[model samples]
Target: MMTDSADEKPTETVAERGMWGNFRRWLGRGEDDLQDRLFALDDAIAHHPSTAINYVLRGECYLQIGYNQLAERDFEQALELGRSALARSAWGFGAQVAQDRAVRGLRIARRR
Candidate 1:
């Protein structure tokens, strides 16, 4: 019978503080150079291994640095993660977007 507003905010913010939080925070840090961005993304993935965007970003960093093979590996892994039930639960509504990003990355990676 307790209708307290104090308990409502946390239920809504769970996604924000989890996978979505890290991904959105990374995007909010605009104009960071590739190396710094890559390092941050690596750390993010180390903690949130199921987050698809981190994989995509790391793959992009590898691609930009002429490491096409590593880029391809990450891209492939991103796609796999995108399709997983665990990752999908974390993604919530962004699941399709994550898959789309991985597919696009793969296309670019395959051109080499």
Candidate 2:
């Protein structure tokens, strides 16, 4: 039988070099950091492509990450989706929120 030592470092896979350093850097980011939030929002948008709110959320994430062009595109898409939903009367308050968020995101993106 073989036993692993506690002092031994685990094998690296994600990155051969500076993996722990990278992890430490990632951990140093604040709770409100948008980099991690962006990934979750990306998956949400992927699964719910027609959801206007997801687009608005992702747009805000992009805005926080300083990706102005991407933020603008997402905001525009959210606005379009919200408008269509309202036109069909399919979404009431939800569509209004999406439109409002998209408008705010667009304004900030354009300003940057």
lDDT of 1 by residue, 55-86 (tens): 88888777777888888889888888878844
Model 2, 1-103: lDDT tens per residue?
2225777666432233343443343333455766665765675566568879878877877776799999999999999999988998854788999999999
- Off by more than 4 A, model 2: 1-33
Worst 10 residues of 2 by lDDT: 11-20
Best by lDDT: 2
Residue 66 accuracy (lDDT) in model 2: 90
TM-score of 2: 0.68
Against the unseen true structure, what C-alpha lDDT does each candidate score?
A: 0.72, 0.76
Please report how far candidate 2 places residue 33 from its true position, in Å: 4.5
